[model samples]
Target: MAGLRRGRRPDEQPPEVRMTTLPTGAELLRYVVLVTGVIIAPGADLALVLTSAVRGGRQGGLATTMGIVSGVFVWAALAGAGLAGVLVASATGYLMLRLAGAAYLLFLGIKFLAQSRSVAPPVDRTGGAGKARSFWSYFRRGWVADVMNPKMAVFYLAVLSNFLHPGDFLPGKVFFLALVHASIGLLWFSSISLAVGRSNILARNPRVRRMLNLAGGAVLVLLSIEVALPMQW
Candidate 1:
């Protein structure tokens, strides 16, 4: 066929066709590593998971994890739509979101402190409407906690922006990145939940339970204060 393109086989392609523009394996690995680091870092999200696990057992922790994962995807969608940037750019919007998150955290901390003072009924370990209700309750808590936190919106905006291509399938790629992040979070938080669930010592010792509640509550209170303080985004 027109001299058969002397020096190249029929199946051979041009140098320009060597690879597609998609993310390479190395780049994907790097992204995974970076996301893993972010997932493992201590933050309000982790605190919420631990507290929920301790209070409600493995199911609670898992539910909360699901909620957080859902929130991550929501943020990703918002970022892909360019709404996250708009919110972050507006000081008043950011302020309101931050304050709302802080207020929720403060309320949770106060509840924990109050709980530490009194012996409430044992968490229902049976399966039924009660269990479903409890699971959804924790799920809502996790969802609200994540949604109210402006930091998450900013984080997704900053991180996902790096991998974005102006003309590519932007939302698909952004969601893929978020899925990676959420997968890491689910595994890590699930392990914590399992471990905390297995620790029956909390059920056995009131003092230890109170101590953990106090510690968890203190951490949330401190985080809330930190969140409320204005910072350069």
Candidate 2:
């Protein structure tokens, strides 16, 4: 014991991190439910997901869903961990992240708009089969995409903070919140997948697809503005 190193050595095995399971209150649950509903209520993330599902087939849509959910995980973690306050308060920090999110949303919106405008029937060249990216890669992409989204980060911080109490129980509350958020994300994304999996009616028609793309693009642009600009409302 006397000779043993106090700190973890480069090759030494790391201590196992304990994962605690804690219960939450109705208020927290309610917040989670409300946020889920809010997210479901017509926004760019959902729109892009639905469009991806419609155009790219099941995996593409699934990838987008996974990405979106991953984002929820990031946002929830940030909110729960106390980083959200700093993110929302500092003009420089907030603006930087906000702009990054806005740029991403804008790019996605423009890309979809371009896709919608193409004269030739758009190719689903997500590379016929063999070129499909790794499943994890897509999942990570979705998670990172949402994680980087400032609207969501700020939204959770400003709105969800009301339900959270400052105490030892906070960690537990955040965990529960993350679970609820992720579940909502999966539920919504799966619904899109099932709808597409069910029929070619909406997905196959160029007219419907164009509408979906344009609508999604518009929503994203709106979200971008909301993130980038100050809002009294």
Candidate 3:
């Protein structure tokens, strides 16, 4: 065996080495599809976007969309920094985030429910005439809702690990995938916002608006309850 090994070329590579390259085109497509499915699934984020669009129109919905995307970038940065593992491993950290997120969702849901009963037209939360100020208000709500969810950190840590390999540059690849996720989210949610916002019939009809508010509020409240429950992860 020793003599045969010595006769072999020094430049010969092991089979394991063949698997260490960056994600192939097919792998990337698979990842994108997975991400899209996750984003499109009904969740607090979708509920929030629909409500914001109904209440504040396209600007509000787009602002909220940007906020959620920003949160996605933050999670990507955390993963790249290697902090996501710490979050996943720490029970206290996870519990605190879960509670805070649940509370925020509950509050938003109640507010929406209360507003649904009002006869007045939908108004921005800031009550300010400045478009920028109102935009920031909705934006901050979306950001807070996303950032408070511990599941995002867990998801990032879990999924990114599968895509990584030994000796590869971690941060760049993570960000690249994150960029794809964020781009898909932006496009998908923006389309939803525009479609909902441009509906003159829905906007003009109080009954329809009330029904949407009730639905959005109920979804948010149920999500909050779901989030508050103990997660197996």
Q: Write the per-residue lDDT of candidate 1 for residues 139-179, one digit (tens) a residue.
A: 99888998888889888878877777555677567777888
Candidate 3 lDDT tens digits, 103-142:
9999999988987897567664554567888899889988
Give the winner by TM-score: 1 or 3: 3
**Cα-lDDT of candidate 1:** 0.83
Better of 2 and 3 by TM-score: 3
For residue 163, what is the lDDT in candidate 1?
77
Off by over 4 Å in 2: 1-25, 119-131, 134-141, 166-169
In candidate 3 the C-alpha lDDT for residue 221 amounts to 94
Of the candidates shown, which would achieve the greatest TM-score relative to the real structure? 3
Ranking by lDDT: 3, 1, 2
Order of quality (TM-score): 3, 1, 2
Candidates' TM-scores? Answer: 0.86, 0.76, 0.87
Model 1 root mean square deviation, Cα atoms: 5.2
Number of backbone collisions per candidate: 0, 2, 0
Of candidate 1, the 10-residue stretch with the lowest lDDT total is: 15-24
Model 3: number of backbone collisions: 0
Q: Better model by lDDT, 2 or 3? A: 3
Tens digit per residue, CA lDDT, model 2, 1-233? 54556666668887765554443567656676687777688776676776676556577678878778777767777887778887888888988987887787777778777777753444455554633554454455466658777777667887657755444466676767777777887888878867874567664577877777777777777877876785997
